[model samples]
Target: MSIVIIQGPHAHGLASGELQRNLQPLALAAGRTLEWFRCHELRDFVACVRSAKRRASEFMLLDPGELGLQAMAHPEAGLGDALDEVDTPYVEVHEDASTELGIQPGQHHAPVATVIINGDIGCSYRIGLGIALRQLDDEGIAVRAA
Candidate 1:
C-alpha cells in the first residue's frame, strides 16, 4: 500500500514546485514515495480514483480544483459518486484561504473527505499528508508510513 495524489487543473506551476519541495522530506522519512496525477478533466479525476482503487492505495490526496467547482455548479456531475467507487481514504486539500483559485474547503467535497486541509498550498499538503500518514499508523496499516 502506498500514497497517491490526484490534483485538479491549475495554471500556477509554483504551487506544485513548492509542494514537491515540502513533501519530499516527509515522504522520505515515511519510507514512502507518492504517485501524483494532475487531472485535466473531471473524467480524468474519476479514472485516476478508479486506478487508485485498483491498486488499493493506502490513501488518496485530492486537490479538488475544478472538481469542487463542478460539484457546486452541477451536483449531478457525480464527482462524489466517482469518489465512492474507491474505498481508499481521501484527504481533501485546498489552496490557502487567502489566494484560492476557485474552490475552498467545506464547499462541496466535505461530505466524502476523510480530512480537509486549508492553508498555504505546500503547508496544506504537508498537513494533509501528515494527517493521512498518522491515520494509516493509527489504523495499524503500517508505521513505515501511509
Candidate 2:
C-alpha cells in the first residue's frame, strides 16, 4: 500500500528525521510506498492531505506535533474542518508522547481520524504506519499503483 505521512514541527527537541529512519525501511521491506511531508503551518497541513487524497493514497498518518495546539484552538471549523473535508482516512501519530512529557493531546480524539498511536520517539510512526497498512489490507484494498 501507499501511505502519506503528514508530520508537524516537533516540540521538546524531538528530531523529525528519527521517524523517517524508522518508517522507511519497514515500508520498503513490506512492498509499501510512503510519502512524508512536514508541515509548519495549518494551510500546508491541509494541502498535503488533499494532495495525498488526490493522489489516491490508501491511507494517511498524521502527526500534528506542536501544530496540534493550533488545531485545538480552532476546532470549531479550522484544521479539523479541513481534515473532515479531505476525507482521507488517517491515524493520528504522537512521537515521544509519554504523559511525563506533558504534551497536550489536542488531536487525539479527533473525530475524523481512524486511530491514534502514541509511543516513544520514532516508534509511533512505525506503529501507526503498520496499523494503517493492516487496516487497508483488511479492507482488501490493492497495493499502491505503479
Candidate 3:
C-alpha cells in the first residue's frame, strides 16, 4: 500500500525525519513493503495523498498534532476548515503518546528501537506503521540535532 505521511510543522526538531526512518522497522517486522511519501506543505501533502490514492488501494495521512483537530479547534483558522477537502481518513498522533511508541526528549533522527504505530488503515503494512508511529509518539522522541 502507498502511505503518504503528512509531517505537519508542529512536528518539531527531527520528528519528521525520524518518523520517516522509523517506518522501515515497521515494514521489516511486518515483512511488508511500504511506499512512504514525506511532506510538509499542505499542497504537497494533498498532492501526495491524491497520487497515492490513484496508485494504491489503501492510503493514510498521519499528522501528530491532529491537523484536523487543530484546524477545527479554531473556527477562523482556514486550516481546520480545509480538512474537509481531504476525502481520505486520517490518524492524529498526539504530543503526549505512550512510551511504547519510542518517544523521547532531545532526540534527533528516527528511533532505532521498535516503532510505535497508530491510526487507520486496511493493509497490514499500514497497521505496522501505525503501531510504530504510536511508539514514537509515546516516547516523545524526535529527529532533531542533539
Candidate 4:
C-alpha cells in the first residue's frame, strides 16, 4: 500500500529527516510504499493532497505546521475544505497539543481520523504509521513487507 506524508511550511527548518528516519521501521514492517511532501505554500499543500486523493493513498499523515493553523483560523484560506476532499483516512500530527492551539482534528467537517503525538514530530509519524497499518489489517488488507 502507498502512504503519503504532507508537511506544511514550518517544517522546512525542522528535523524532518529525523522524522522520516523514525518512520522507516514502521513503514517497512507494514510493507507500505512511502512518499513525503514538504509544502512551502498553502496552494502547494492543497495540490499535493489533491494528488494523493487521485492516487488513492491508503492513508495520509499530515503535519500542517503554521500554514495550516493559520488557514484553519481563516475561512477564506480554504485549506480545511481542500483537505476535506481527501477520501483517504488521515491522521493529523501536531507539534503542539490541540489544547494549546484550541483546535481539534476533523473540526469544521474535515475528515481527520485522529490527531497524534503532539509536540513530537518523529514519534507522531511513527505512531501514525502503526495506526494506519493496524487499520489496514483490520480491514483485511494485506500490507506488503518492504
Candidate 5:
C-alpha cells in the first residue's frame, strides 16, 4: 500500500524530521510505502495535496497544523477545498484538540475516515499508520513485503 503524508506549516524543520522518523518504522512493518510533503504556506499545502491526489495514494495522513484551522476559518484560503477533492481515505492528526482550533468531530470540511491523537504528534502517526494498515487489510489490498 502507498500512503502520502502532508505536513502543514507547523510541521516544518525539526518537527517534520521527527514525524518521518517516528512514522518510518511503523510503515515498514506494515509493508507500506510512504511519501512525505511538507507545506510551509497555504499555497504549498494546496499544491502538495493536489499532487497527492494526482499520485492516487491509497491512504493519506495529514497534520494540517495551524494552516488547516486558518483555512477552515477562511474559505478563500482553499486548503479545505483542495482536501475535499481527494477521494482517498484519510486520517487527520492534530497536536492539540480539535476544539482548540474551533473544529469538532464530523465537522471537518473534508471527507476523512477519522481524526487521531489530538494532543500527541508522535503517537498520532503511529496510530494513523495502524488505522490505514488495518483498513487496507480489510479491503484485501496487498501490501508490498519489506
Candidate 6:
C-alpha cells in the first residue's frame, strides 16, 4: 500500500518558512515528493484528506505539534470539533509513546495504530497528541488531522 505523509507549517509551531526548512530533510529521507497545501478553512482540509485516501492505499499523517497547540490556545474555537465532524481516521505524534503505555521507551513498545483526534497545545501539546495517538492506535485507524 502506498503511504501519504501530511505535515505543514500550520501543523508545526513554526511559520511557513521554518516549516519548509524542517520538512526539506524529511522529504528527502522519504524518497518521494509531497503535496503541500495551505489550510485556510476546515472544509478544504477535509477535501484534501479524502483526495489523499483516494490516491493512496495507506495514508500516514505526520502532524506537526502546532495544530494541536493552536487548538489548545483557543479552546473555545473547538479545534477538534471540525475533525470530529468530518468522521475520518487520523493520528498525532508522540514524544514518549512508552510513558503513556507504562513501559520503557525502547522495549515492549506498542506502536500507535489508530486515528488521532487532537486538541493539545503549548507545553502540554505533545501530551495531547500522545493521548489521541494512543486512542487511535488502540482502535487501529489511520491518522488524518486538519
Q: Is candidate 1 or candidate 5 better by lDDT?
A: 5
> For residues 45-135, what per-residue lDDT tens digits would candidate 4 score against the true structure?
7788778878889888877777666655665666556666776777777666541223355574343445555666666667677777778
Judged by lDDT against the true structure, how good is candidate 4?
0.70
In the predicted model 5, the residue pairs found to clash are none
Task: Look at candidate 3 and tell me the lDDT of residue 127.
Answer: 48
Clashes (N, CA, C under 3 Å) per candidate: 0, 0, 32, 1, 0, 13
Please report the TM-score between candidate 6 and the true structure: 0.38
| Ranking of all candidate structures by their TM-score, best first | 4, 5, 1, 2, 3, 6
lDDT of 3 at 19: 55
- Write candidate 5's Cα lDDT for 1-146 as tens digits: 58998877654333678778877888888788899987777778778876787897988887777676666677676655666677577777766665123334455444344455555677877777788888877676454542
Q: Which residue ranges in model 2 land beyond 4 Å of their true spot?
A: 96-119, 141-146
Q: In model 3, which runs have C-alpha deviations exceeding 4 angstroms?
A: 64-90, 96-146
lDDT of model 5 at residue 118?
A: 56
User: What lDDT does model 3 reach?
Assistant: 0.42
Model 2 residue 132 distance off true place after TM-score fit, in angstroms: 0.9
Question: Alpha carbon lDDT of residue 40, candidate 1?
Answer: 79
Task: Rank the candidate models, highest lDDT first.
Answer: 5, 4, 1, 2, 3, 6
Clashing pairs in 2: none
Q: Which runs in model 1 stand beyond 4 Å of their true positions?
A: 11-14, 96-119, 141-146
For candidate 1, what is the lDDT? 0.67
Give the TM-score (vs. native) of candidate 4.
0.78
Candidate 5's clash total is 0
TM-score of 2: 0.74
The model with the greater TM-score, 2 or 4, is: 4
**Alpha carbon lDDT at 125, candidate 3:** 32
